[model samples]
Target: MADRPEVEISYDLERIDFERTSELIRASYWGEKRTDAINRRAFDHSACAAAFIDGQQVGFARAMTDYACFAYLCDVIVWPDKRGAGIGKKLVQAMLDHPDLAGIPAFSLRTSDAHSFYEAFGFEVSRDGMYMRFVR
Candidate 1:
């Protein structure tokens, strides 16, 4: 059979079925700071969301937001096998166009190498920017 048509774009958070989503995320994420527990927690909170394709969850993104004013893009990943498919753009555009998350005063994320990628979605960094972290 010819290749099946790709799944349409959709957005969800912990609300989507978990086992499948988690399984896809496990394969998609292959970075130094990766952990199942961390991934679980990342989407478990209400502040995050994901995109599923053919029920396989080919892309994922999450944000830290108060839901009223601020949103910080935290995790954005697309399965290695699914790159060049335009899923990443659709995924992020869904979040930015979301009614629940519109009008965010600021959206923030830091990447060692994705400056141009995030820039496609209107993200920019200033020379005065600084980030601080503390032990919990």
Candidate 2:
């Protein structure tokens, strides 16, 4: 795949096109349908990475991190048409490499599917029954 064209992954939130990103997430199965105000606020507080091909946004992944030891990766999505092109993998890599997140001891995400995709990056399922949670 050396000859495959390059896709630019960027961490500049100001360069992110919010409308496109919102639409991308809203269309996903595990997506949040948030208002523009809420979405903007989330973007403002999170370390966001987006993948662009020739200037069109095709992928996104963001992590809420303390810029120190932990990051919770969320809202990872790649446009369906672009899925097989390695954009999702590249976007996740960009998030992991973001300066605030690199070297963090722990990263966590919840996915009902795509386990193997993330496992390839060394994420392992918690040992059976090792995790407990509460939600309202």
Clashes per candidate, residues 3 or more apart or on different chains: 0, 0
C-alpha lDDT score of every prediction, in listed order: 0.63, 0.79
Those runs of model 1 whose alpha carbons end farther than 4 Å from true positions after fitting are: 1-7, 14-31, 128-136
Candidate 2: C-alpha RMSD to true structure equals: 4.6
**Among all candidates shown, the one with the greatest lDDT:** 2
- For candidate 2, write residues 1-136 as lDDT tens digits: 5565589999988788899888777777766667677778888999899999998888889987788877888888887888888898898888877877787878888777777788788777655522211111
Q: Which 10-residue window of candidate 1 scores lowest in summed lDDT? A: 127-136
Question: Which 10-residue span in candidate 2 carries the lowest summed lDDT?
Answer: 127-136
What's the TM-score of every candidate structure?
Answer: 0.71, 0.86
lDDT of 1 at 79: 69
What shift in Å separates residue 62 of candidate 2 from its native position after superposition? 0.1
Model 2: number of backbone collisions: 0
Model 1 clash tally, residue pairs: 0
The sequence of per-residue lDDT tens digits that candidate 1 reaches over residues 1-136 is 5664475555556346566555665665333455667767767764555566767667766777787767767566766788777777777777676666777766666566666766777777656443211111
Candidate 1 — which pairs collide?
A: none
